[model samples]
Target: MTARFDVAVVGLGAMGSAALAFLAARGVKAIGFDAYFPAHALSSSHGDSRLIRLGYFEDPSYVPLLKRAYQNWRSLEARLRTDILTITGVLQIGAPDGKIVSGTRSSCELHGLAHEALDKAEMARRFPAFQLDDHEIGLLDPQGGYLRPEAAVMGYLKLAAEDGAVLHFGEKVTAVEPDDAGVTIVSDTGQYRVKKIVVATGSWIAELVPQLRRAAVPIRQVVAWYQPQDGFATQPQRMPCFLRDEGAEGSYFGFPAIGVDGVKIGRHAHFREPIDPNQPNPPVNEADLALLDGFIRKRVPGAAGLRVKATTCRYTMLPSEDFLLDHMPGEKNVVVASPCSGHGFKFTSVIGEILADLAIDGQTDLPIDAFSFARI
Candidate 1:
């Protein structure tokens, strides 16, 4: 019932897949396990697409990580021979002094990234779908883009397996123990002992790490796909991906019509009754669809009345809405990365590289001090 490996990765989704891929490529003896296969709808990596932006509005500390993420994504795309990222620009829309606009501007300024600021009149003229208020403005980051979430996960895992990394699907880890002899991973199928263990169990972290469990909250998120009335013409060919902070209502965002699953849109934040990950996602209710419809009606009129399809996802939130990337306190052989807080997918490539580095060298050059467990 017990096997051995050099490194054992739990929850091989975005971050874990990347870690396995990177480790396998480096000739490290790595093995990965997942309760479900990559791109499964049950996990956070299900969405057809995810936004990747360089001008982070959350904080400037993420700028360096994002820079590395961009490069890593490109490298993965080339290695997989598939386009995992689209370089369409991104737009931050809000009041001139609002968090979306002002914070993004500050991050770009601090990092010396190339960006453009536009007033309401100019924004309306350039991107007519957005109905900005009189005092609102837009910050355009050319480096911001969209990533193919499902494709990226599959690509990483596929390449990892091809490079001699063992992947076990439909196997969920139930317990983890780490000591001087390294770590032991127990799951339904069997037990795995390795020199090191990496826990990347997205929303399931609450169940795996009891001490840090309360710090990670799982919440439901709803995303909608609408048929564009006139397709790309109404939204334009190069229309930037948009993030809008509607102040009291809530912050929302969307992407251009990519001809895959209609024009995708969703709110950036929401409140939902928590549920166990093993259970099916709750049904998408009328109010959830209404919220997305309302946003589109006011901001994206072209896609407002079109027939809409909707689905639900989950976000494992940290109190600070930052990532938890570090070694387990008092346990040197165990590393944990979780609670990407709804915004972690885009950085999975770089995060995977960093996780591999941490396991191998016990340290990373990436600026992850702000995302340590001590902060939680």
Candidate 2:
């Protein structure tokens, strides 16, 4: 059987759920489909917590967009009456001149946001859990915090449903085609025809958007949870979420032990081989564990030598590590937003609003030119 709607959102994950909710709130006839439910651990949105900060180290252009994200997140929290975002502050630690520290400082300075720069000794004095090296420094963004990924997804989905959005779970999209009238979506359960389609599929973007197959590489990332040792007893309440640049090697980041009861850490860049999202995730090998263990030991000494529980997640990365939020090449009615490059979760709220605005009005005020496919 086939059904039709004004808008059909494929892949109702973090960004999609919020987009769907925004569209439904506007009284638009929208339908959402996901291979799994909103809170399912199968996708990037399943983690217990995601870091949300205003001073974007990736690029200063993101500062304006992040400002909107903060507002939207608060609006969602107020509407849902759920604590989706916690303002626990954030720390960017690295060499004083490295991207993690310098770029963050640049963004904060450009935006005139409140921030503090601290030397290694000052960092230790303020954030006692971090064992910074002699050359390391820290930039503190007091407005930064963490977002409840699972709760935010569920909250958006629930609000979307309440606003009259239909959702189909376990409906993996098999095909998508654009024609004169609109777009057609084929899935295992059935087919759907809608005037417009928003493809927010994260790691599966290559499958749905063939043009980006080479540009978007799906990578397997492991997130580990560890109980803090005696030195980190104050980590949960006092320590800020942090991003640490390991110099020329790469970078890794982590959040404080929130409701989860442990510190969570993961690398920002490393081995990222493509994978079948349907298959079971690859095992976390000793080498991977050792790498994380070494990171914790050297930088986060308080979090080292603790029991570690790890789970695998996927990141759809674009070449520039930005995002691809634009129409599908020549197809204006079909929008594609994907390959968040592992840092897109924090901006889901604002991205979703942008997608909805684009779907409805054909453009948005958000500074998404950096994320345009034309830039790729």
Candidate 2 residue-wise lDDT, 55-111, digit = tens: 888888999999999999999999999899888788999898998889999999999
Expressed as tens digits, the lDDT of each residue in 320-340 for candidate 1 is: 888989998888888898959
Against the reference, the lDDT scores of all candidates come to 0.84, 0.85
| Candidate 2 accuracy as TM-score | 0.96
For each candidate, give its TM-score against the true structure: 0.96, 0.96
RMSD of each: 1.6, 1.6
Instruction: Give candidate 1 regions above 4 Å deviation.
Output: 1-3, 234-236
Provide the lowest-lDDT 10-residue window in model 1.
229-238
* Prediction 1 TM-score vs. true: 0.96
- Candidate 2 error regions (>4 Å): 1-3, 231-233
Model 1 residue pairs with clashes: none
